[model samples]
Target: MNEDQENDMIQRWVRDTPEEDLKPEDYQHIKTLGSACLTEGNSAQLLTFIQDEKNQGIVKSMGFVLIEPLVNEVVKKEKSLEHCQAAITHLTRVSKLFINHIMRHFFVSSLSSGMTFLLQLDDRKAACVGLVLSALQKQLTRLPVPYTKQLEEADEYGLCRCCTALADFTKSFVQEIKSKNGNYVGTTEDEELRTELLKFCMRSLRELLLDAELSRDRKSSLWLFATEIMVTLPAIQQSLSELLFFNSLKKSIQMDDCQSKESRACLAYLLFVQLITIESFPAVFSPVFVLQCNMEYINQLLSRYAESHLLKGLALYAKSLESVEDNSLPVSLLELQSFYNVPQNLRHILTDCPMQHLRASGLQVFQLFINKLDSEAKHKFFRCMLKTRNHAGVEGYIIKNIKNQVEFSMKPGNASKWFLGVEFLSLLGLVLHLSQGAETDLLNSMDRIMESLNLLRYLLIRDKELRSRTGVWEELCRIKDDYLKMLRVCISLSRAYYSAELKALKDNQKIKAKDQQTDCVLCRYVSQVLHSALVTFDLMESLIVRIEELTEEKLKIPN
Candidate 1:
């Protein structure tokens, strides 16, 4: 259309009585006028049209349409640099007008749309878009905070969207912008964007980000964004400490009505796990205190069936326990409930997790946590596992570690003497008994039986020392005799049962081969499993014999 015809159409549309609700066609026509302004190099005219008294209602309803085309024009690659620069300047004016005029009264969703688009653009094109936003930074800085109360009032006019977009924008420069004597490098604009974006992240942590009602996907995404900013900008760590302070953390301690407390816990989890390096973790809050404060949160996450939550919880625990000293623990074991609860969740992960890698990771963390404790803690932990944890695989692990601690304590000057006393013998008694006698399900108790045999063998091999301990050798001998006799009976019965099954499967396989039928794949699998069980029993019997030999050898030696 010619200039006069376009101007006349614009005037007619802008001056027309505002619709109660704009039709789709009305939005299209408004966008067409915005495009016309860009084409005519008079982008100011669109803003003027919005500013007109008659079009105030239309502008409030559809001002976002006016800004959209200006953003498009700035990002248009075919345009000359001069043309793009002009478009950016006009976009700045339109943005300011929208934030001041439309956003105050109604939420403007497109306020961050240009930014989202810019993120996808080539560097040069994005730079042009950045210039547009840079001009609007003053207006954006004036927008209300993104917390719920203010959002309820006016939605921060899309400031949340802006913050998320700027977060992505800030990430690209993180590696390039190095700190020199505490001042940031890069352009004035990047430094400014980083400062403003950090403020938004911290505020969100205090408010919007802390809302417990936030979806898991949303919460995780926000966490990643916030972590990137904090990691890249080390200076913000101190500011983050203020919000995540131990004393200030009491608001969410009960975790009943407060979403912020839970949210704060999540932030702490991410910071310590992903953002803060292990060596640099602040000494102000003891690792135990951090663990205590976040114990419920950690347990809640670990209890979740999702692999993501499980992994996140594991990472948090690993960091929380990294710096903790055995001596730093309180005198009352009751105070260590959180530390106590971790092993059960770790057991669940080990036995129940469908993912193999995650199970391996859980085991590594579990063993590391166990190794960090002193001998007394290890003793109590082993007893607790034997009593409460019914899973044989888990019980076997506890027994194995108990055996390890015993060996460690026996070494000269080891300082871990708790495992060498009457308490150790008592702990040993709980796990060595075959509760159901020979009728026990050998397949089910495979791990427990094997580890128990190893523990007995180790004790027997250390007979030189035990014989001098008075009553210790006699008690161990009795425990060994009873345990081995019952074990021999159970192993014989199990080997007989599985051996028959294996022979039957082999016969079945021969019949299938003669008939030229599909091979009994299931029969082969059953045979393999049965054979493995029989082999395991063989290992157990050998262990029993080795223990007896050591006992006989020790008897010949004078005390």
Candidate 2:
């Protein structure tokens, strides 16, 4: 959209929000719909209508712009929660399987977008986070094409919402753990919740990282997305450690010494870091991994490739070793350790490193993954981020870095984050498409991604008049052609989300729109769940940002 149109939409949306979120009509509508969905075998009817294309598109888009603001409002206020609590209570009364069935129907599109929208608004961040997460069941399968495609269209907004919501949802949990500040063996009840949550988080992370619909630069969203889940990890250590089987997975992928040795090593470390960041660690592992595959074999293969940029980034972020000035830290390094210590195993990469690699252009984010990566490199080749140390700024640094990589702005500019995010998504989609269900042969995908990045990188470097580091810029004549190339890749990958057909209906719109009592429960409930995650995360950020504002101080860590 042009400037005027985008601005107008924003203004209208902002102005339209109600002062008090309680809407008598919304609850009445929810109750009526709840009655229908709960009636025997009606869920199949609810499911059938949404899969209809016209029904899916209009419903998914129309809800937030119309119905969802009411949902968002109710979620933000304590008094208004009765609307949601009543809905969830009624559904629970019906059957959890019924709720799960309804959610799975719209689980991807409507729910993900709802979560994103609420996250943007800071008022109800925490509760929304919890609520949003509660929407999905374990073992979610590939949804209908129309629904999944809706998500690719909604990804940026969806991801942002999910992250913000998760961040907010986990705030209390984080604080409680921090306050306790001891070796933690959580309560069995708490441990069960933590395990369920981590399983959900890791699976989501895996999917986000693997999703081809994302662009290369926007791929960093995967990490930020991972971080939202990771930052919440320390609070649920026992559960995470217990659920992830990374060690066993690591034991299986061997790096035969051919030319692929370097790539194999990188894959191993990526998987290792993936394991470590589980928010739970060594606790979940077993000697079963040792029996399955030798560490000696792993070390033998990886040691040869460890010197590549792949492993360099891992060591810097996870271990945090100090480096001699003689060899400056690689910009692609996402996690690191200080120079002083013996190599240690912390299983805490996401909290520590934002610069983990994906796609071929890993070095693009070398500078923004952490406050430290923000440090200047060679007088403007890469400038350090000039922001404060409080949580909001910290989070912004993450967002800024993520955006610089690539995401769904639709508009292209010099932001490496946005460009690369699309690239990452596209390349991931390439592999998923190419894999056609096989384990990724990274060597081939890596080659295609590297070629794409090189072309784009050359465009960025050659554009003399480009904005050096701002988030927005005109998709001007200079880099226009290359960006189009990038855009096309994402467009193709987005097809995986497409379906052979959206079920046809006889006067379907009339049936759906007329029978207001029989609303799309999947869309309504899923949206509610999403908003909860988004609002809570944003609230925590607002709280942290507000604290920074009140104290007029930044939380500085001396180098």
Candidate 3:
């Protein structure tokens, strides 16, 4: 048949073939004709026929039977690079025509099948892998935003499958490189092909790392992929390290100057930091550690950018040191400690940085160091912290910080303000707990109780104000109710204990042989505890009343 007649015949067959009734043999026949058209340099006719949008549902239903098996067939032939490349190119072109959930699955599966075959061909693996990856990258990039949004919002299982497939492809590609023993002694074309493949892998990783559409769980899979590559293939570690660090640094720099870019850059920085400090992986002496030895790198980061995310990244890097198993500190860590002066830096950050997040990071680093220390060291550290102005006054400082957060949240268009407020409240609770331990003398418990009541009162007022404006009373209600319940029980116990102590003091006063001064001190202590308990009861009662008013107002709102 002439080309025009053949084309007309295929078009008729495509139209006549009922999608529901089509069998494997029918798809095989179509694949055969498509392959012939591709070989005869009439790809335009073949593409136009197969890619007709009207037949998309039909084509999508036949995707696995039509495309995947053909890909497998081409892969199984152990063909020359040109043959394999042509097959992949044709498949890629056809895959682009139908971009949907079903097509993505079929396309990725086909590419994965091809990759399995290509990895076995020592001479052609580089070029073949590059082609397959390029195809996969194109398909992923072309994923419709609505589809991706669906994955992000509700289709966690589908999202996980997609992320796993991407990670598997990355793992396979890295395995191919590792199989070569980091030696690519091939022709210029082969070397260039390998370079392109590496770049493709890096780009895939970059996209995965920086993909804002992905949830943390999906992004974590990518981190696992990158860490596996870094652990198994030493050569790529340096390049991957440089890529992640530079990308994070770039984003951090942008974040410092642009408030609008903060969320994206901050997320990217956090993911990169996780990649940079793959402490969960078994320890290998990596050259990347050498970068840590230079205090100048950290100093430059601190001196150059005042962003909280950057500081948080640095804090995470420092925290990674605790993962080391040996008694002796890593030389890099020692250098970090000696030069960066982590405790001093944390003190400075806590005292100086106006941002709550930075202060939180500082606290995190301090806690990490404390946890790493021995009991004696921890004791000394706590003593030192108790004496430090910032540490001692952390409650007041954190309350002020929370007030600042509340003020910021009051601004219009702050969607995340409620979450930010919750975080600050949680932080306030933590500071209150820490302050309890800071009071070394039991005689000062009364003083600590009063301090806590004052903090709680301030928090209640602030919360009341916030609730009045935002109607965000659910969390505050829980906090207030829980505190009130606990305080009521404490007040009852204190009243009982005070009555018993008064009876004992009266008996001791009657017994002249007893130590009058000691009895007097005991009486005074009981009175103080009773006084603090009553004050706390009054404060909590006021808070409850305020909360009831807010609840009433909320209930009055029309549905």
Candidate 4:
């Protein structure tokens, strides 16, 4: 048969469900071998049959996706529900091939996404979703094992298609949960199914939290999956807390420090904070053994991945506020402090960390986290700033980047675009609030504002067309009042008996920025190190206001 004919057959196979009377066990027996076979590295047929379905096999493709995988791994002794329970654990344990096969099976390109199909199976429908989702999460976050079977994710178009499919699956799973909260004690079959599912969820997530020896490929993937699972755990609450101490102990062995340990740990902690679950915290953060982390490897990922990566991790840990259960997820702001900032090992990567693809990806991860936190959480985050006043792990960057914006006037060219964006929005917003004196930290410096002012002037000088753009002028003008408020802060802070702690940083000798001569010791000290654009504060603020006025109609720059 031609490729088209073969795809048609596979699609029909998926759409054609076996008789409804067939036991889930019988279904398992028939499909398990095919599933296992499909998982064995590259299956050109899996991709070909699924990808080229000529609008004919859409439903069949989904059916075949489930049956093919079940056929591969199901054993003769494994009964259906038991096999289903096994299915979850089996997929989690299988080599990455399983993940790839499952993912390709669910492949719905952006083009085909809006194309609807008759999806009628009840139990199997959810089972397929849970299985594939569980598998994909593992594959994406974890590093692929040595010589693991691989496929062409190299092509940009294919990656985009995969991303689209993944997004759809994630959305569907979320919607399924939102559909309703069915009664748990309603019936025997319902109870049995829930029990099996709970086990599956628990086992996979446990691996994520407590598994000590995750292969490098699985490590990162598991970290992300673990977080996504948190959103599902409220319903699976009992399973979440059910694991015995012994089981928890066994899993702890796998968490031994490899390179991404800190980031993994951070992800684990973030899940707890966001989900408010304490069920597995002790297991995941088991201080069971005193494993020393490889500080050098960590520093490298932090510096190279992003200053923001390090910052976000530290902030999430420090702001661990109260979880829903008593002391569930209990690493205090102080306990987790050691992981923040560039440790000696990672300093080399931080030296001019490029804001290229890698760092940008890290930023995306950072946003995924911060966006989940509500306003109260955000307020709590800042409150941690008070706790870390003396601790630089979290505050050093904020002080260096935002509060020290004036120093950036020197090389404004090298300043990070991310830093500049935050400088105008969050940090500066904080400064403006603090300057109001309605509730301000008098110790805050005004020199930061002056530096941003300088940076703005620099931008205006270089980009006349930008200056001419109403949006640019609007931004500068709007923030003009903010600058005045900051000026008040500088005066207030300088006038107050200084922190005395920062006196050294405030001294003239410490400054290295060339424009330092005319500025105050605080301004010079900060500007010396800052690489902000040398735009004037008022002009910078005005630029934004102009931007707002010109495009104030809320146009989306037609990207």
Top-lDDT structure, candidate number: 1
Candidate 3 lDDT, 297-337, residue by residue in tens: 33334442446334634544463445533222332343345
Error of 3 at 149 (Å): 18
Clashes of each: 0, 68, 0, 88
CA-only RMSD, every prediction: 13.4, 28.8, 20.4, 21.7
Models 1 onward score TM values of 0.60, 0.27, 0.40, 0.28
In model 4, where do residues sit more than 4 Å from their true spots? 1-106, 109-131, 134-167, 170-183, 186-559
Q: Judging by lDDT, tell me the better candidate of 2 and 3.
A: 3
Could you give me the TM-score of model 3 versus the true structure?
0.40
Clashing pairs in 1: none
lDDT of 1 by residue, 1-559 (tens): 3558556655655566444544767767867867876777764555455566655545555555555566666666444445445544444444434564434422234445565565566445435544554545434555654433434334446655554555655554443334432544445554544454444444444333333222224454344545554565354323445545543433312334344444555566657765533345566776766767666657766777865567667777777777777434443443466566767888889998899988988988888777666677777777878988477898898889988888877888873445766666788788788878999887788888889888888887776656666577788778878888888998899889888888888887888888888456777678789878888888888888888888888788877
RMSD of 3: 20.4
Summarize candidate 2's per-residue lDDT along 226-322 as a digit string, tens digits: 4555555455443332222233222112223332223322322333434435333443333333212222223333223222332434332332211
lDDT ranking, high to low = 1, 3, 4, 2
Q: Answer with 1 or 2, whichever has the higher lDDT.
A: 1
What is the TM-score of candidate 4?
Answer: 0.28
Error of 2 at 400 (Å): 48
